[model samples]
Target: MYRLLLQNALRPSLQKRRMKDIWVWNGMRMTEVDRIMLGLRQRIKQLDENVVILEKEDDRNLYGAISLRIIELELAEILALLDTLNRTTSNYHHLIIETTAQLQDMMDTMVALVKFDKMQVIKKEHENQQIKKDLEKCKNEQKATLPPPTLSPGHCGLGQMVNVSGPKTYSLTAYGTSYSFGAWGRDVNPAPGNDKYWLVVLSSSNVYGHYVRQYSTLSTLLLGLGPTDTYISSSNPTTNTIQGPNMVMYGNALYYNCYYTLSICRFNMTTRTVSTVALPKDAGYNSKFPFGILGKSYDYTDIDFATDESSLYVIYATTGNFGNVVITKVETSTTPVLGETWYTSLYKATATNTFMVCGVLYATRYIDKETEQIFYSFDTKTNEERYDLKIHIRKMQPNIEYLNYDPRDHLLYVYSDAYIVTYEVMFQ
Candidate 1:
């Protein structure tokens, strides 16, 4: 009889233990539900706030449109959840489980938001492409609307060159030939004691081929370009060589390079003689080790010279085991001679690229994990080392594939692969 009584008491205690275990499990679940529901409520509140803000603003730009879409999606989800809540009976345990499930749904919505941000990157790239196309159209239209010329300047096709006599604007002296390439005009004043004369580089393609003219503009008439004897002919079968000269004016001379050989040349306006400068010889070609000249390899394409009225500095790239871009200074004071030691790049030759802008030479080189962009200010007075801005990449467009700076307006123009852009740089 006593054993039976003890067994009954043990059964009740065991049952009570089982009830406690069930309560503990339910308590843990309720805690998880509370945290998850709180997170859901916060996210929904944020989304609602965003929807209100987006509704009030004008969505002319891209960000506004994206915000609007996100708001719409969030509202749709919230409405669906509200419908479920209204239909369902709200007992304590049931309410907890339902709220936890709703929290999971909000988490999924947040995941979708993250994915949308990633997709927006592609959208931004597309917008950049559209901007580039619009810019190209505007440029062509501007080219077409230039005033008609009054007189034929010479054999060269006169591009957009305007002559301002006092204040009244006059039509540019036209070119006799139908030339398609563009030309740029600059006032070239030779070193010490020469009058300021207009230097015009004109490019054109004809039945014969392509021709680039270097003309001296004293009056409206173009004094014969080049040596009055030597003429420029297109050697590259791939390109129309007369597609407007890529001429950069230093102090007194203009510098450019030929495509086939990577040879750079300079023309002294006073002497009227064109002379070639020696470039580092190619290490020779191998089937396994062929070199590719990236970007524009045409003459006057990828080279920039730093100079004043008296001296010229040539910077060009050559390829070997690595790529080599050599900076050699040439003193034109007596005989044209190489001065100072050459600057070997810290990185391998293939790892770096060089460009010059606004009397400064900028190099974009590959760093360990990042691309290192630095500029060297060439000083003529010291006749020595060029100063470098170490690892500096602010306020300058290092990703610019093509860069041109107008000193007159201090407007820096850069053309990347996707877009042509402009920046106003503050000089220190």
Candidate 2:
């Protein structure tokens, strides 16, 4: 019984030690969990702060974008208003200048009339004095040699009635080409400084290729030049061959517009070499349709080639933007280079064709058969537009497809679907 009591006491002591160790281990685990929970709280606070900062930044960026858009809108409005005001002011200034010019013209006309009346009065006085002197001389002659008896009225009537004929009729001999060069002739230009009156005709055929024919005169025989295929060298071999629709000859070189490549092809007659000049970036060409179809159809490239007194020029506009014309002067020596460019508000699509006369651009449109042909001219010298020039075309056709002004003959040539006509341009 004493041993049993000792064993019970030892078991109690062992149980107490085990309980103390378990308590120490749980205390250490509780301290680690508390440290982890505190770190989590601190991380959560930092995340909240970051989110708030990001939200504020986003709001600032959105507000900044909106402010910029508003500024842009305001700036656009201001620019539009400025443009309107400038146009209005320019129109008003033009009106005032025109009115002043008219008034000045009227004053000058009045002065001219007054001077003319004064001169007329002086002239009448001098005439009267001369008449009086003539009468006195006649009287002296009559006195010197007894005046012959006046012829009887009956005899005078008999002589006057012997041969009474109407005034001689007169007729003007019409001057122009009666022969019609077939409709395929795209362009005709007079050779520069040629005594034989050489004409270069640009004609195209699938079989013969795009070629030029040189005629000694419009009436003379034709001599075919090189087919474009023989002369043109493609920059890209995979690309289709370029052909010229319109061409102008300057000196010994011929400049042509290649719609396929959107380039100007220059052929040197002397060297027999072909080179190309790239068109402006804005110059648009329609490649959706085949060349043959496009050439025959109404949808055509707006690019045109022309020559003035000084240099060659390229006239072009974008597709659907034919109202705005851009003209560039081209210099062709060893290579073709674009020179001075001019922008015009004139709509090129409205006209059948345009040509340059003494640096002035002229456009023509077809009206009815009876009405006089109308013309719109833009003078490059003064940058003035005149839309009131009316010209009469005899036996006018319904449609005039091409109108070209030949500076050599000072004649305007009109090409209809069937016939080619020429008119003498008389300037007052």
Candidate 3:
């Protein structure tokens, strides 16, 4: 959407520039290079996400491909620079010619490597789809053979992670892509009269979101209807608005990381009052330790609120924990208070995002721009940790600014690049 709007705005100027100079019309294909570089910039931003995924997978072929990708990006950058350089002197012209040719050859090889990587990605996706079909059929057969001597199934009781599918894009943001980094979903624990789809988009610096837009239902949100409710937590951005993308709506209120502080804030919708509880052991905040692998951190994600079948939990990293993820149960029925705490071995900085289901915490890392891998798990029930759950998640975009599991429908609502996407979680 951003790209469409940008290209539309550029069309008139681009045409004007084209008509003004014949040389520009013919020789300035580098303008197109600028467009290509725009895509390259996006890929470059995901370098951290890619590195995290590649390191964990430990596939030598993928490692090599990443190496080639890095080289290709560098060469592409250099080639663009060389091509756009002002030709003021012929003194170094011959040298530039030789260097450009050598770099061009290297670029070609790297481009081939890039193509090979793309093919590998496509091939892997095909294999995964085939496996999914087989698994689905086999699951049905297995279900037919199972005994029905069980209690009623729900959240933690219903199942464990078997598979995740579909971003199932529901709607564009009420506010468009400029407010891309945001959070949206239905109230996990709505008061009877307060069940409305809500969206919170960061405004005025894209760090703090003060207002929330509420829709009546999935139909209203998907159809882009006007919000039924639009309320601000505070008139001031720094006072009570949410600090980060990690948030959840529960019990006619919004729970989130408080702005500029290492604390959880609960904004009651009924009275419009805000209550907060500071984290234990001086947890990091204000862009300190955040979600993201490598240097590509999602700013102000120092505190994350997640919901599962049982209750709401806060996921954060403290200095005492050395930036490792710390999970604490948050009681939402009353004044928000921290309850049972569980420490984990996973570093908060390494995980792109996390969610809770059946007392088990699942962490994700980027597989690529279009997919994410659920590679880490911490079972709070038994206090056991597992790193081998290779659950794959389909994503519409690379950056998942906000993600939380909803117990009501067993869906994962994700605010990714200002798009509200929900995934159907198949349980085992």
lDDT against the true structure, per candidate, is 0.40, 0.48, 0.75
| Clash pairs detected, candidate 3 | none
Question: Which pairs, if any, clash in model 1?
Answer: 257-299, 323-349, 323-350
For 1-428, candidate 3 gives per-residue lDDT tens digits of 32344346446644543343344345444454445445444543454354445456656575667665764565455345333432321224455588899999999999999999999999999999999997896466445323322311334566656667666665676576787788888888787777888888887677888877788888888777977655555454767777888889888789988877767888887787889888975788888888886658898888988988768899998888888999999988657988999999899988899998877888998768876878888878677787766667767777788889988888999988878899977775
Candidate 3 C-alpha RMSD relative to the actual structure:
33.3
lDDT of 1 by residue, 170-193 (tens): 122234334221222332334665
Q: Which numbered prediction scores highest in lDDT against the true structure?
A: 3
Better of 1 and 3 by lDDT: 3
- List where candidate 2 sits over 4 angstroms from the true fold: 1-209, 221-245, 287-301, 319-322, 369-372, 394-398
Instruction: Give the TM-score comparing model 2 with the true structure, all chains together.
Output: 0.45
Count of backbone collisions within predicted model 1: 3
How many Å off is the CA of 214 in candidate 2?
0.9
| Models, CA RMSD each | 27.6, 39.4, 33.3
The lowest-lDDT stretch of 10 consecutive residues in candidate 3 is 145-154
Q: What C-alpha lDDT, on a 0 to 100 scale, does residue 370 get in candidate 1? A: 20
